[model samples]
Target: MPRVEVAEQPGVGLDGSARPSEDVVVVRPDAVIVLDGATSLRTDLPSGGWYASRLAAAIAERLEEPHPADPADVLAAAIRAVSAENGFVAGHSPSSTVALLRWTETAVDALVLGDSPVIAFGPGGPTVLADDRLAAVPRRGGGGYRTRLRSGAGYGPDHVAALRESGAAMDRLRNREGGFWVAEADPAAAYRARRARWPRAEVHAVLMATDGVSCGVDDYQIFPDWQAVLDLARRHGPRAVLDRVRAAERSDPDGSRWPRPKPHDDQVLVLVEDMALA
Candidate 1:
């Protein structure tokens, strides 16, 4: 059987921000799934956290049964189940990202939606299993080609420094116009954006994390070692990692200092190893 491990961190903002960590993860013999709720949009059904939690739980439960390897049906059912239970569709329209990596006896299959990435690693280093938005703020000057930014914390040094010096850039980073973020809501696009090559490789470990974690690293640094992050999580635990990230973002001298009552974006990671190979 496959082994699983998980960690979740809450962002640093708001009265009940600590209560609404939107990161979710699943570890099973056959697969691992990670879900990250969006940060911009709000929901009436208790808040964005409800949607993210319900969707993750529903999907995890569905995976317990035999189903198609495609994450689309899994997500579609999860959305319906959660929405029905919540009783109001629009009340919980927070968009979120999804990363699901399924391992079969002979091969591996995966899917991703909205930027939360899935990475598979081995001796050759790592390869991305799936790619999603992973960004909260929209790219500059609109259109798909522009570099997407994040709200509050997670801005690049130049942007952060500028925002710290002047309030104007902060406003731009938080702007909802030209396609800002909305948490836990169904992604405007499907999570099944790509497929992965799990069978051909001698997999060591797999990782999935939200933008909050990715922000700490460089864009070119995709698929940083899962073992390293997992080691940090193991030694310090998830809460500590979150606290450290919050502190770093809060104290970052770069002008993009996160304002008080910071948004509590949930952070989570899923780690797994191939049991058969072991």
Candidate 2:
């Protein structure tokens, strides 16, 4: 069995009430699962966090069922259940991004929906398992692409100028038209899961995190160094990282620290290790 560790923080609201952020790290008979909820600014209720927690719980329950189905099928069923439970009609109010990791004796499978990222670190570096939803936005002219700053340090006149130039680059990208795009969570297509073998030599750690944690993260496009992140979490605890990200966003004038909006979204990070140690 694999042991899992999870951390999460809440978001502040207008009336001084802090909305709950949902996260879970569970070890089921089939696999270890990590999930994060997506909060929307448009909603009056706390659907994001609410759904995140509910979804994770539901997934866990399904996995524990006598005849657990495929991970992908189970996820799709959960999405449909949420829609029925909430009366959330099609093309309307959705809940959260989903990231799941299923480990069998021979192979491991990963499934993700939306921009929330999941990463795996083996003997080499980190291999990103999911896509960043925001990366799909088209630049102004489609000539260049806009890159978000990892932190306050990424902001400046030069970066701003590049952002403007990237508008054209984005337009160019739009013209090509044959690339991956981030669309709304598809309870169906997002169901396609990927699988890979766990190398006996180099499998060390796998990290699953919501986008909020990515705000202050660097070299993330590549596999992030798990030890370094673990060190930070150990010294300051998870909330410390969220605090720094919030401060970094506030320090920037351009609002470039988007996604890291004030009050900040709930940050969820889950770290997993191979069961060989056990």
Candidate 3:
């Protein structure tokens, strides 16, 4: 048997407004799913938060069916279901990143799209499954693109316009040639996601997290490594890891230390422990 626990927290925008968090966490006896909705650059379509929640629910429903299916097939089906329900056209709606893990009596399977990650801890140590192609997209403004968004001195209308143009360019590259893939309206992208499998006896625990919780280690270097993260979760639970991330973000409110587009992002973490040891 496996025991699962989860924790989540919504992030506030720069304007000090409360909006729905775009992260979703789903846990089952033999599986875990984590999704992070991409922020929408267009205003004419549904918000990413709405898309993520709906997609997550759809995936959950599919997983509940008696017949087992490949994770990629399940995700593809869920994407189509959500798109049909919302009347969203491909390449015109909001999208999300996905990370999934499923375990059976003999093996464990995993998938990752966009940047969210699924990590497995085994007798050999920890193995991280992530997709970094999205982050490799070229930026037009070198490194100061995020700094220009702040008001007071360096902000300018031209900078904002440039940022918008850059965003549009990135959107075009999505799900196309020389570009990365995500859980968008296009079901074909699901097949392009990274996938892996391992013997069930080799894994002791697993963790699925959106970028918000992972950024603390991958981006901020707040902790020494991923092992530190697992240890913290084991001692204080998933919320403790999220609280540490929020505290780190608060300390760098100006983005001086970490130059990211948003001050904080919605955080979601799920931990699955193998109960056989107990």
Candidate 4:
């Protein structure tokens, strides 16, 4: 068994209103799963947060059916089931990134679909499992919105228009070949997740996080590296890491410094440590 510590907070929208976080975390006896739903800008479709809750439930249900089910297989089945439940069409449905880490008596397994990542700390050093396809895909001036925000534009009517414009543009590339894969209505996307395995004895701890929390390291440089993140989580608990992310956001409230989509995004972190390591 592993000792799990977690901390999560809902995102604050541009208006400074708290919204239910689209991030989900599932801690099974043998696995830790994290999902970060993309924010839904379209009114016709269901919200990403709502879709993520249903997907998380589906995933949890499938994990209990048999022992050590392949994470990719489980995710595919869940996506199929969830898609059927909502009768959603590909390229038009809400989506979420996935990060999964499962452990058995002999091995540790990790899978990452989309931007959410899973980091495993073992005797061999830290191993990161992440899918960067969404980021790697080319876009039409993808940084334009952020740059606008940083240039004293602020989050106002123009920001909303820019969001709509970017969202429509990205819709064409989503789920398409050579573009990016995410957990939407397409079950095949789950199979495209990144995967890795390691000897159970070698792994001492695992860290799973949604992009909101990870942006602190990946974008804002809040802690330097993943090793530093692990050190903080192990020493001060997962809450400490979240606090650091929040503080960073607070310092740049108007998006003048970081120029993010929103002032504060939904944040969630999970640290699973081997009991033997304790």
Best by lDDT: 4
Off by over 4 Å in 4: 275-278
Quote each prediction's TM-score: 0.66, 0.68, 0.91, 0.95
Model 4 clashing-pair count? 0
Per-residue lDDT tens digits for candidate 1, residues 1-278, read 56666667666433333465766776766777777765432223355455566777787888888655366677767766666675644323555667778776666667776567776776777677545332444333531111222233333444333333332332333213443322233332344355575663477667677766654443323325555565565576645544555555555432233332133345676666553374
- lDDT string for model 2 (1-278, tens) is 66666666665532224665555456565566666554444444445666676777777888877777877788877766766676765444435666777665555567766556666766666677765433655334432222344333343455545554553343333212343321123456444434344543354566777766765564222214545665566576656556665566556544444422233545777766663343
Indicate the worst ten consecutive residues by lDDT in candidate 1.
143-152
Question: In candidate 2, how many clashes are counted?
Answer: 15
TM-score of 4: 0.95
For model 1, the local distance difference test gives 0.55
Put the candidates in TM-score order, highest first.
Answer: 4, 3, 2, 1
Q: Write the per-residue lDDT of candidate 4 for residues 1-278, one digit (tens) a residue.
A: 78999899888755667777889888888778888888888889988888888998899898888663688889999999999999998988999988888777888888898898888888777788878898788756645677787787878768877877877877888888888878999999988889999888888888899888888888899889899999998889988999899899888877888977788889899988873342
Deviation of model 4 at 52, angstroms? 0.7
Which lDDT values do the candidates have, in the order given?
Answer: 0.55, 0.56, 0.82, 0.85
In candidate 4 the C-alpha lDDT for residue 88 amounts to 92
